[model samples]
Target: MEFDLSWPVLWNGLFWPLIRLTFFISVGLLVGNLIESLQWTRYAAKLADPLARRARLGDISAASFTMAFFSGITANTMLSEAHEKGEISDRELILSNLFNSLPTYFLHLPTIFFIAAPFIGSAAAVYVGLTAFAAIIRTMAIVFSGKFLLPPIKEGCLPCRLDEMEKKRDTKSALQKTWARFKKRLPKVLYLTCPIYTLFFVFKQIGMFAWLQGFMSGSASFFTFLPPEALGIVVFHMAAEFTAGLAAAGAMISDTSLTQTQVILALMLGNVLSSPMRAFRHQFPYYAGIFRPRMAFKLILYNQVTRGLTIALVGTAYALLMT
Candidate 1:
């Protein structure tokens, strides 16, 4: 079983995708930063304050939650600073981070949707929409928990310090801030994206994904709920980047045999299976840098567990109702 390891095959597969993904991701980041620099997210934060207050979180924690919509790093940093100052307890610190997850998911929503749209068409919307729904559910659960478990705050105003956030807003024009952010973020994005994308392309050209699809087919009894072709989507998802799954699902979209619901279920299942590893690999380091290693691990554990359960619940309900 020979495969094309030729330069042309490698170049064609890697070049165009890397270009498209880079462009879309850059635009997404720029949009996110512009919204932040322009203070557009302030309104969202204002609206979320009622929810934060109901959860009995103090102004500092609520402010961190607001910061999350634009930059999760900054938001977590705020929480870490507050924790260090004893402005909030350990439990509040963790709960605040978890509460911010909904916005955190949204920080990359544009990138994910734009990337998936080209590959999976309308199903991209469905898949992203479902994941966003799961994020909302998880956040709501955190809010409910906070309401019951955490004591009330006597802070004069929940959104008062929200005005303090304006001090950090960029003075430059939106376009200038967007360009600066693009320059700063693009290199880091490409550093990781280039090697990983090239390796996945090589794997695809070399039949790695095909072999996994065969394995999934052989193990079909276990995943009885999903269609056979849909197994390839799950395989690609688990094997490589989320785009790999979209690519597989995209290919399957043209096949008249499979329904859109089946493709969505496969995506949801792939997301459920793949999220834990991704969190541990990508999130742990960042969290550790901000908080202690122990704290970071706790946050990651809570995040992955809660995320998995909520997404699974949404998937199960979707399957029952739609399929």
Candidate 2:
């Protein structure tokens, strides 16, 4: 058996996508860190205070919600400390952590949007918007759960001292921190991205994607709503990092056969399917380090299940409206 490889095809597949994504990732991370360093997201917590009150989240949980916009670990740390001190019950801790989902999503929104836009173009807007919507849904669900499952709290929920944190912001410091973070993060992102893009390119050249689509045709009933090429996107999303899925989507976006709606829907579907495994792999250690191992697993399970269902519901609505 012989294999034919062309430099021009490989170059087009790999070079352009890598360069574009790298540029976007770098700019996105720098700007994102800068914005975060400026402490602008503190306002999110303020706006959420009313909801927090309605849900009867106490001072520590409210403070942690504010802190989550800056550092999830720090916010979670606060909850863990409170749990240790017996300031809050186990149910309240879990519910409060779940309620922070919106702030956490917004904290990462800039980076996610910028990184996605370069590859998926306008579809990024639709996809990110849907995910944002799903985050809102999850947060609302948590709020309702807290209201029903937990007892009412005292009248006073100590306001977060975000203003104190905001007063310390310095543009020079923000820039320096952004630069340092960009330097540390960009290389690692590219390290994963380059190899994945190259491998995806090779898979494309070998007609593996087509074969996989055909092979999975028997199972296509499950995804009758999506085109066969969409299986490639979902597979890449589940098997590799998000960039791999974006690379696959980027490659397919140019193909005249696939409509923009189909591509967007595919990305949404991939997100719904991939989030569980991704959350488990990435969030387990962080959660476990802060909470007990069993609690960490429970948190991960709940987060993924909530995220998946919300995204699936939102995606279904989108598919119905668009298609």
Candidate 3:
């Protein structure tokens, strides 16, 4: 069947993607800034003493991982800033960020399941539960490993000293500070949103996504001998944002011959594979400015390696348990 390419249909497809992206990006900016001001700053201050070096390392690692797992884009920016300020060394910063990315896999599962429930019926519950369980397990693994995984801090480097000239800000005024930060982030949110919306619409109108999905399908078939639906999902995932990839996966869930476990595995794999591309498209420039290109590359590579190993191990265990 020839798909309709009418203006109305195009507009309909573009509407949700645009709205969702803008809303999430805006929320990410506001909430992210507030999180930084309150929680992050306090954490930094609490661990600023020389005696708390080990504790500081763990806190930094956990926080970086939490942010990455929950929200990669915002978390990555925060990590870069943290590294620049020397709160953490380049190596530690990268390891923490990478470790956190794995947990992010399960972070969005609840929302994704709720959104998919209407279409997939009861099976949505199973998918959501399994994915959430996987994420929790991964989080635990990282936490346990964090005790030994992080390298020792350099001797004589006083715990990220706050200069005497830099007076502490009033933490009690959180609401006001949050509002101010939100206002400041408004322009940046719009800056990213406008281009993202425009590109999303233009791609939809040109049928670019379909062609890209087709290419993915072909590749998946060639490599994994999987059917079109699985391949299409993996492809959409690689080529587009998470929401777009999930939407494509949802569309094919009922029609595909793959088992539930297979579908979930495919989706998870797609999420992992898409990370580097997503980082390159959105984060590289920001990080490049703070750290030299070589430093940025090393940081990202370290992150990917750590995250990849964590995910592979955790994903294998999850698959084994489910099977």
Candidate 4:
């Protein structure tokens, strides 16, 4: 066997995907950004104060819950400050963080859908759809839990500086703002997505995923719930992030004769299993650093359990329906 090397990585895996991704992402980002700027105002946090109040959170917590939509760190920092000030309790902290789940998911939905629609194709909708539904369920659970499990606030919420709070507004016209956001987000999406897409394709071409498939077959009984073809995707998800896992799932979707249901089930299953590790790696440290250790641990635990259950519920429904 002769060794070959000459922009193989660039031409072989990256070229078409780069071209396809560039066009789709450029257009999608523009459209998605415009929609975000024009349609949804950041005042959702202020607007959601009533719902948050019903859920037993005070003004400060509700405000933080709203801030979560734009920036989780901002939301979380506010939560920490409120916690330090005794405005919210441990229970409120846990519930509020969970309530922010939907917004946090929404925060990235545009980016994920726009990027995925092209890279992952038709399957992108299904993959994003299931998670969105799951996020919705988790949000519902938080609301109900807050209403039933926690007591409603009697004392007025702290006098958070609502007057000083500001929403991000661009001075430019919608088109200019869209163009600016599109340009800003485009490189970031491509930087993350392009390399992952390319690497996954190269790995597939060289048969890394094939080995994973073969490896999983011996233990197929372990994943009896998932279709045989999806085992590789599950493995990839368990080992890496959604980018690699979805990339693998997308390849199967585009190349193999796998049906949409199979792809959805596979990706969902991967999502179900992989979330805990992600929580540990990302959520755990961030929360611990910001919140007290025990509080962080509890918050992370609640979120992981809630998220896992939500995904599992969706996956079960899909599996049963498919069967």
Candidate 5:
């Protein structure tokens, strides 16, 4: 078997994706660090105060809600510690945790958008936007529930002067920090991105996607709502990781076989359907460790259900609008 390694295949498959993604990641890290250094993360904590107050949670949760955007486990740890110490009631604990959903989305939006644009291009914006919308809905729902269920309190539920909050104001200058963040994030980006795109390219070269496309051809009839060519994207999205799904969708998009709405909806469906299992696998055990098992089960279950419904409803509406 003489190897058929050719320049076209190598350039298209490996070099281009790597270079594009690396450039995007570099720019993304720069923007991400700049945004963080500007006190946006701390600002998020201050903004969450009203919601936390409405939820009747301790001021501590305001801090936790802000942290959730940048680091979920850290936020959860703070909330869990408050619960353990009898500072917040069960309802407050759950509601406050739920309220952090929006913050978490905002926390990572810069990174997601910057990297997504280069690979998925503009369509990446739609999917990320939909998810962000869902997070907003989830936060709103939590707010309404908190306002209606919890009684009004007089004391300041807001934490002390947020101005004093550790700004993570590193000693390094902005340029140094941006360079450091870019360096720190590159490995993770490459790890997640390079292998997936390369493998998909190999699969393309070997006709695996073609075979799967044929096998999955009935998508026009089955999915009905989406373009037929989107079958590969849906299959890869559901069967493999999200980047794989995005890779497949991006290919179809470049060829103009699938519309942006179809790509968004397909990825949305994958996200909704995959969310529960993902929550069980990742959140349940983690939550159990933080809270007691029973409480953890309840918290994770609520989070999963709220998230799934939000995504499904928003995605369905978008799909219908597209149709």
Candidate 6:
């Protein structure tokens, strides 16, 4: 098939999404990082006290995860920086992130359910209930795992003398330090966010959505038992970005005969499965700067594995509950 390949369509579809993505990601990174840094610096010294640092790390990690649960991009960036700065260890960082991912998925619970409830009519309760149950159970798993199974630090892991001195000589106030760090990181964050935006726009412009829909529709026949939209979402999830998967699910739910539960499941699975790839796109660079490529890869691998297992378990539970 000969494509139009016109400039106007390209700009409208590709350029716009790209621009919007860049703007949102940039704003998220800047504001999120600044707030996190302020909180960290303000409490770091106090928490880092000889009597408090260890306990503080746990609390901070939990708080970070909670923030991330609500919003992934910003919180993940902040927590990764914290990990690099020795505020938290590798295990704690990974566990915190994994724990946060499920909550983040449910952050839109009220909105999603509210929207789906009217559309699905009475069946909405089963859909929402199953999804909520799954999220809660997954969160509990992360919490229990973090509390008992997470590794303990080796003796003298915290820099007692250095921490004390740093706490004593806090020259710049928390707000000042936060602003300084924000300024320093702003350029890099924009540079990264801009390209992602551009790419998103380009993908949209090139009729990628149409192609994805056709391909997924064809494949849906093979997985006839599962909801076509859900299967389609999983397929698009593997090939494209999370937004693509979400868009596909939204379109399918509106047009196709998919249940609300199926749509939510697809969206959740698409999001969870696509995380490793997304992290590679955004987080790998920051991580690589702090550690070698190999080390960064290992860290990402650890994160993906932990996150995947948690998501899978939750998804399974949701599916079972739905049945």
- Across 1-323, the per-residue lDDT of candidate 6 in tens digits comes to 44555777766655565566555555656656666644543343334233222323354554555565456666566666677678777767666665555567577777766665654454446555655665565556666665465655444433443354455444357557767776776676556555544554445456674565455435444645566557877777656755565566667667865766787667556656556656665555444433445656776787677656656677677778888
Clashes of each: 0, 0, 2, 0, 0, 3
Candidate lDDT scores, in order, read 0.75, 0.72, 0.58, 0.69, 0.68, 0.58
Q: Which of the numbered candidates is closest to the native, going by highest lDDT?
A: 1
For model 2, residues 1-323, the per-residue Cα lDDT tens digits are 33456677656766766676556545545544554556543554466677887787876677678777876766775676568669789899889888888989999999999998998898889889989999999988988888889888765434444646646567788888768866775566566556655665666577775565444433434887777788777777655668888888988987755777777777777777667655764455445545676887888887888888998899889888985
Top candidate on TM-score is: 1
Estimate the lDDT of model 5: 0.68
- The pairs that clash in candidate 1 are none
Clashing pairs in 6: 14-201, 18-197, 69-104
lDDT of 5 at 54: 62
**Model 6: lowest-lDDT 10 consecutive positions:** 48-57
The better candidate by TM-score, 4 or 6, is 4
Each prediction's Cα RMSD?
7.5, 9.6, 7.2, 10.3, 10.2, 6.7
TM-score of each candidate?
0.69, 0.67, 0.54, 0.66, 0.64, 0.60
lDDT tens per residue, model 1, 71-107: 7766775676558668789999989989999999999
Residue 124 accuracy (lDDT) in model 6: 47
- Off by more than 4 A, model 5: 1-47, 157-223
Q: Which of candidates 1 and 2 reaches a greater lDDT?
A: 1
What are the per-residue Cα lDDT tens digits for candidate 4 across 1-323?
A: 22234576557655755676557545545544554444332244457877786777766567666667777765775666557668678888888889899989999999988876765688788778888999999988787788887886765433243433354545367678777865765566556555555555566567665565455434534877666668777777666667777777778778875777887787777777666655654454345545666777788888889998999898788678778
Deviation from native of the Cα of residue 234 in model 6, angstroms: 9.7
